[model samples]
Target: MKLRETLEAQEFEPYIHITRGPGDGGHWARQYAHRFDLVLISGGDGTICEVINGLSGTDKPIAIFPSGTENLFAREMGVLPDCDQLIQTLKWGRRVVMDMGQVNHRKFLLLSGVGFDAHVLLELNKFRTGNITHLTYFWPIWRTLWEYRFPPMTVEADGEIIVENARGLMFVSNISRYAVGLRICEQARYDDGLLDICFYHCTHQFRLVKHAWNTVMRTHCRDSMVTYRQAKKIRVTSTEPIPFETDGDPVGNLPAEFSVIPQAVRVILPP
Candidate 1:
């Protein structure tokens, strides 16, 4: 109600949309995006991904309102909705073009993960409910750490082999921050026209934990088991389908290919 009144006062007609379920935001955006100059999306990372994918291949600009569980992308951009900063940005913000990652046919604005992280997401989605909080992730992480059988796969970037027969975890990041503000791919740039890849080749849970700790410390890039680099395209091939996550949403299994769409979307951001 407040947002509607505020927009009305500003002489902007805002259409309030309540998503019916997953994919609704993107559906609505795709249906109505042709009529709007800028679209404001309110939700967590997953919802953001939904809307981003909805607006893919278009020049429409989007403003994010962080109202979801893990507003990681919002924090990365240093804009939290419902604050004076967000209001100021809405009224007077600079437009920047940001790269987006595409996994198969789906698009993602943040990062995408395969193997262990994807498994965690698959489990996590089973219980995702109202007002998702950090606590919603604890059980999934714990269970995935113990039970996930890291499957073997081959990773190639730009048609060159990066890893072969690897059974660890891989992430393709367009933005720097993962959930909890972990700098999993610290050197990533959203507008760089390239995606950053982080591959950890240790399947042991203890070593994985150590690498995660190093990520928390922002030193994982230097670890021996970790491989970090930039790529325009990455192809992951597995003997069987491997689960993958895009911006924290559990996307389908891989034999997946990922590539960047350079400056795919115009986004309003704080200066």
Candidate 2:
């Protein structure tokens, strides 16, 4: 209501549609996909994922208003907190073509993780109730560290074939940062027409601790155990079924094919 009022007061023409239940965002997005010039999403990562899924292949751009606990994608674009400022900025903002990642047919704006990270989200969903909070992920993160077992997977990217035999996490990002401001893929650029892939090949507690420290210091990519690469396409296959999460939502199990849609979607960003 506040956002709507602010936009209306600014004399900016905006359309508002509310969803009734889960997965209703996709339906609402499709309904307005052709009618709007740009779609302003005012919700969490899950909602943004739904909107992207709906607007895939369309030329219309998207502007985001971060209203969720973890607005990972919005944070990357540097969106402001004030709704009025956001509206004013959008008036003069340029639409930049940014890369989007696809797992099978689903689209993701931020990052996707296979193995460890996916297991964490899977566990988190089991305990999530109405209105999720940041604290809601604490237990799951802790449990994932202690009890989670990693699966070995073969990763093929940039003409390099590597088999990771330990319990580890793989991050395929269009943007540099992941959750908690981790620069796992430090050299990544959103509009680079390529995907940055990071693989952590250590499962030992001490090594994981060291990797986490390096991640905090933004030097994780330099670690010998961590392999970083850029590619237009990546294919991962595992002997056991490994679940994967895209833009914070669990999509499906591997073998997963990740590819970059170069300069595919337009987004309103700061000048």
lDDT of 1 by residue, 79-114 (tens): 777655666777899889888888898888899999
Candidate models: Cα lDDT each: 0.85, 0.83
How do all models score by TM-score? 0.94, 0.94
Whole-structure CA lDDT of model 2: 0.83
Give candidates' CA RMSD values in order.
Answer: 1.6, 1.6
Instruction: Give the range where candidate 1 is weakest over 10 consecutive residues by summed lDDT.
Output: 80-89
**1-271 per-residue lDDT for model 2 (tens digits):** 8988898888878888876767798888876778877788888878987887788878888888888876778877788667765876678886789888888878888889998789889999898888878788889989888876677888989567855554577899999878777778888888998999898886655677788899998888778888889998899888898899998888899988889988877788765
In model 1, pairs of residues that clash are 44-68
